[model samples]
Target: MKRKINSFSRKITNNPNLPAAHAMLYATGMRESDFCKAQIGIVSNWYEGNPCNMHLDILGKKIKLSVINQKNLIGFQFTTIGVSDGITMGTPGMRFSLPSRELIADSIETVVEAHHYDGVIAIPGCDKNMPGVMISLLRLNRPSIIVYGGSISSGFYNEKKLDIVSSFEALGEKNTCKISEEEYKNIIKNSCPGPGSCGGMYTANTMASALEAMGMSLPYSSSSPSTSENKKKECKIVSTFIQKLLERKVKPKDIVTKTSIENGVKLAMCLGGSTNLILHFLAIAKSANVHFTLKDFQKISNQVPLIGNLKPSGIFLMEDIHKIGGTPVIIKYLLNQGILSGDCLTVTGETLHENMKKIPNINFNQKIIYPLNNPIKKNGHIRILYGNLSPEGSVAKITGKEGIFFRGEANVFDSEEDANKAILNHKIQTGEVIVIRYVGPIGGPGMPEMLKPTSYIMGSGLGKNVALITDGRFSGGSHGFVVGHITPEAQSGGLIAFVRNGDFIKIDAENNLLTLEVEEEEIQKRKKEWIPPLLKVKKGYLYKYIKTVSPASEGCVTDQF
Candidate 1:
């Protein structure tokens, strides 16, 4: 029989496997006689190949020292894969990016749970890293802390800040010969200067903000630039925060309550954060057993308004948000507006209101974030619509600036590549609703974000006139009159697949609707010939994903129970 540890060291520690554990530690030169006191796992998603996470290696080293030298806890550092969405976009490699979220979550669970670590601190910089670590924390139900790797400062081109989105649009600009090859090369060199996730309110920053609002991270931890000394300070500060959490035995489930989840959505809408958050937030709530649905987002949206003046939807960078405080400015303003829940708890071991007492109210001079009463938009920034085209509903990310209603002839393409080709070849016409289908959770196998195509449309100077609709979702860097996350997706026989070229389609966000203005009998007739496409891969994880992953409406999660 394997021996189990007695309860002398603590209730959950100092196991009976003490003899073998001590022997292995002593052999490894970690010669603390009573070493099995407290173990805190420092999980990291660090890789040299991607700028989004390159800083984490250094961050992790500092945190490990703090954990052992200052806090007197034995810290074990481990790493996992971090696939860069920016590097992989518009290629077969992109298929692996979303799948990597699942792998990272599972890896955290496997490593931490297997060791029975008393607490865990996750430092993740890339897009999937935030939610993946949080999901594992929920499952472990241990004292956990999440520290974001931070955003990169905007690079400069044409005397303006250039980010990843600017670079993507520049490609289209070069394709159209509007910009000379020299200008294109200049943008390529100037758009990204150093380590960090792509700048603007892309997935990396959006989800990082979400994690903070969900109370999984320390306040003001999400908006600082990746390379700043402030980011270094934050890692050390959060290290101490985790020690405090371990003392109180507070946990993820205790903090990620229904109110906190709503708080996350409120920040997402107000910040004009990514639409990918819808799927990610749902997955997290499900993991925590929190009762969150699409209606909850809409209910909160009815109360909150668009305030984040940044990114693909707005005109500032995250570095700007950091200048006049950080994400907490928006969080505090929303909290005081009576639109947010004060009953919620955070990782700080206090109620939401208690924590809000420290953050100063929004500075009127701050243009990046406006006062709640004087929001940039009167309605929710992202509106969910349901109609003939998306019977289960679709997402429309509209700034108050973009017209809420659009009626145009359809320019249908079966895949993202096909639509991308049409746009590059000038086959796409003005006043057309470009329908790209068969790229849902199962169909695309990963439902890659349409930044490539959308950026192309904007670069080609048709952003104001043309619109695109897809069963897949969009990056936070994607804007214009685009509607995505069309449910009962193309592969599942949604009306989006039945859309033929030149067919009339309407996306009306004014009343929340996405409709195919075609005869009912004619739609039924097309449905008879509609067949789910064959799997691109014969086997492996993607094949398993097709069988197990649920719909986008259900958060695109693979695990059922």
Candidate 2:
């Protein structure tokens, strides 16, 4: 009889020695394109290859060439090995550029069963990978740890260090003023430097940081550069930690407790994390059967102060964060100030409180992480508002601007494309609330981040006195008074869909209100005749996504649960 080949057989045959291997599985969702794009070399070679090449230039040129240079050359042997490992490790999927959640979940299931793996390590970065991995882990309900692919190196455009957030904004600028093609290419090249973290405090980076803060990740793991010699060490550390977790029989449910979820939310707020986190975290919590909701975020945001001044929100980068003590330092400060749940257990086999003791001292003045007395922002990290425009509640960060909460006439853009065009034309006005509709989960179909246009608006000096409300998400680094993840999104006949240009909209951050100043009867009439935007995707993963994904307020997750 011919041997059968199925998901179960694949699981059993891959690793037959460890019967528990059937219970021990690891899965990682990465932007395979991004991973392939990462630069890798041996430790010594990488140090020697630094742009400055100071090590080579110093210690006398000949000695440098003989000792440093030659030693570095020998280390280059690992470069090919590293690159091959990266490629092979990421070669198991169909969709290379961007894999869907279902694809990731199915791949994870296959890998787990084949390896007879007991636990999983989800190496994910970028927007989709994190959520997909999280969903997969939730379904697997096994021991899991999320390892992020680190941020890309900051690029230079017109003599300025260009990060991913800025790169996207620069794309929308007038052609005459934008960076040259070569410069853009260089920017893309430098934008993603290594492996463990996302480029900026966008959804990817923010979510990773939030996970670390929540004690779901290894200590200092969130901030380590993917290309650093330390990354391999970190990966080994993660693998070892997972093994220990399994030995102890500790599962993801134990780590992702209510207190852990609350800590995650508080960290999200303190970092001024991506509006997407509001949805992603909620979904993760839901998968664990934890009762986390939008109101919980609002409640936490009301108290947690925005710190970590990086990216679109502030200067500095993830590398800078690592130098300034990373998430452990931040958690310690929150714990000292009674802002975080110090007793929560992390995957490190220590309570969050115990982890803080590992850090001898933290300097808030350095500004990598801020203290409660001298915070980056006065109020909580995020604010939740509701009104006739967003009956299901909308989320906004209150870290940057304070004047956007007052009533104003709405300036509606039917789609992100139109909004971009309007901004390019300099049609946006001060005191006008710019509303970008039809870009929510079912609307944008994937609820793509609208950080591009929002960044342009803020960078152009037009956003100083204006507010932006949208069904889309803003990067964690996006400051200013921006409200996002409005649900039911306009596409699903939410009140946001009924919003018209020149309509009076009120955004009261103080009382958590985002009401439209229209009569109930008129609102009802608009709803009756409201036509949902045409679906953005009609086939393939995008189609499945549009059909199965929930609204932004509901975490924009598919029906995997």
After TM-score superposition, the amount by which residue 346's alpha carbon in candidate 1 deviates from its true location, in angstroms, is: 1.4
Per lDDT, the best of the predicted structures is 1
Candidate 2: residue 100 Cα off by (Å): 3.3
Per-residue CA lDDT of model 1 for 396-423, tens digit only, reads: 8888666889999999988899999999
- Measured over all alpha carbons after superposition, the RMSD of each candidate to the real structure, in angstroms, is 2.9, 10.2
lDDT of each: 0.82, 0.62
lDDT of 2 by residue, 228-338 (tens): 545545654554565455446566788888889898878767876777687778778877789888888877877777776776677777777777766677777778888
Model 2 stretches with alpha carbons more than 4 Å out = 1-102, 113-115, 156-160, 171-198, 402-404
lDDT of 1 at 187: 93
TM-score of 2: 0.78
> Candidate 2: what lDDT?
0.62
Please report the candidate that would top TM-score against the real structure: 1
